[model samples]
Target chain A: MTASTDPATKEPFERVVQAHGDVVWKVCRGLLPQHDAEDAWSETFLAAMRAWDRFDGDRVRGWLVTIAHRKALDVLRAGARVETREDGPPDRAVEPPGRDLDLWAALARLPAAQRAAVVHHHLAGLPHADVAALTGSTPAAVRKAASDGVRRLRALMTEEPR
Target chain B: MTESTPTEAAMPTVPATPPQRLEALHRRLEAAATGDDAPDVHYRHLDSAVGGLLVAATEQGVVRVAFAREGEDAVLQALADRVGPRVLRTPGRLDAAAAWLEAYLAGRRQPFPLALDTRLARGFRLSVLDRLREVPYGERVTYAQLAASADAPRAVRAVGTACATNPLPIVIPCHRVTRSDGSTGAYLGGAEVKVRLLELERTGRLPD
Candidate 1:
């Protein structure tokens, strides 16, 4: 067996997925509904594998988060179309309503930027600059979005249920 | 009301449990990535008379056969690092190789029908492996004789090195090469396995 000393090529793509799958899952869950989140997470890795040879970025987590962000957006856009359809069922059971319903409900209330910022920067432990790159904003904007998102989430998590 | 820091508030409260079907999902992703027009390398461990053996093969052919002494994880990690990162632990991809190995270890003397990727061997060392395959079962050849057959009679030491490093052992029959003084030489799977293989070949049964 050949000893591969080159760090750039040493890490197999499988290892990459195994190392970052949980973080990507959390990011997707924070952005999309749980059911759609799994799909987004799978798509993110598939896409990453396709472009793996060309990936020169040192921050693999950042690169993966960026791909997941785009995939999550695609799922949201598709969900929006189905929601707008007049003939759609009133209670589409795409995901079974479960105990995490309140958590998801609170997350859904946050603005898109705030949710992405909180998930990428706070949950995934990516630097603000990396989150900014993913969100297409400056680092300062991402930091502010994360803080505002957390403040709003605190208020929502503590409010008495109706 | 007690105020919480932004970091404390942003701490992910949702249970981060991995999906129940994570393994299945990984398999599906690997399959999709290898779909049509790519060299897919798949591997799996097989229980054999010797021990657990890790077999890896590409669409081209059986590429590597590793003994358990070296540790399957380390061997697989090396395969992943050296070969393409597209390696997956799917046994179905190695059905042909596994069947051939099972038959061979059971003393069936079946020739490996799969193509081989000898990319790991090159130049004179590769030629040495090619010559090693020609050594008939139950027979033995000294390292010098094998070197002579490879048209490099003076490079007997190099011949030994080639046998020691043969990526596809057993199938390539590197175990048939020995020392010139009528003794078994070094083997990649250790000298004991080499002797056992030779004895199995001669007796048409695994030695007790």
Candidate 2:
């Protein structure tokens, strides 16, 4: 039977995961605070594994990180407390330098779509072209959202100490 | 092929940006990408029983599963960089990953059933990977076979290239792709691992 049609012919996928687990975790940790990082880490690798067959292995690392980053954002959007889940979200610190907490808070306050564009480009470090692919949007639209998100962040971060 | 665009100018300089972290993350991920016993411990803790985590996504009804713990950081960063920082990990998203992995490792499962996240690849490479997934696990195929499956029968060399650059390995089962002479070809996870996987399907042994 052909590989595609034969069920028994599929190779084991765990081997690849055994190969790159740590790389997945660091991406989750970087985006998430200690609290919510683990779940994000797990979700990232899991997502990568499920999609392994269709993945072009040329840039495996890039591919995995992209999934993890998106998954982290999904967690944040759910507003699920980090502690409640296996991979919990990090708690907001009392205060962060440069109004970091305020920035995230403002980001959280913005529309989910806008927040995603800003975070992916500014914090995640993806190129615009790649960003376009991930978000299913045109490069022009991604650029606009990023600009708007940044403007919103700056406004929230630099607001008069009211 | 390796040029940076001018649009990068709009990006700001943040001291704590993910780039530095991604550099370190990439090294660990790449090292871990090699299918060796030792793995990067900086972030992921591997337990063979759990079978490591993976993410499977697809387009056009074909799925690719990428198995790597180290790439997790990179995946998250890619999402953040590509999509947005709003990326958060979903709860129990790994259930499917863990289930398929466990079953595959225990020999209880064959034919990886996964969803594909083909957000990155475009064009021909994507088509090739889709076809690669159809190549059965135990049965080996020549590069010529793969090229033909994709309706590009003459592109045997291109088929080899596509297999070499597959982002997802086992899920796509590129290891099943062998030389025309029936000899084992190179595998990203190593020839031994490839042999072992084949043996596992052929003899049901854990292949030495």
Candidate 1 wrongly placed segments (more than 4 Å): A1-8, A79-109, A151-162, B1-10, B36-40, B68-85, B203-208
State the lDDT at B42 in candidate 1.
75
Q: What DockQ values do the models have? A: 0.30, 0.04
Kindly report which residue stretches of model 2 are placed more than 4 angstroms away from their true locations once superposed.
A1-162, B1-46, B49-76, B79-91, B109-112
lDDT of each residue in B27-60, candidate 1, tens digit only: 6565565665243467778988877788888777
TM-score of 1: 0.79
lDDT of 2 by residue, B1-208 (tens): 1023224324333333344444443343333332332211112222443235444332122223434543665544443333222222222234555556556655653736566555455577778888876766568888888888889999888888887767656666788888988888887656777777777667755544
Worst 10 residues of 1 chain B by lDDT: B1-10
lDDT of 2 at A115: 59
User: How many backbone clashes does every candidate have?
Assistant: 0, 86
Q: Write model 2 residue lDDT over A26-60, tens digit each, in one string.
A: 44554555445556665565456445544544566
Report each candidate's C-alpha RMSD, comma-separated, in the order given. 5.2, 15.6
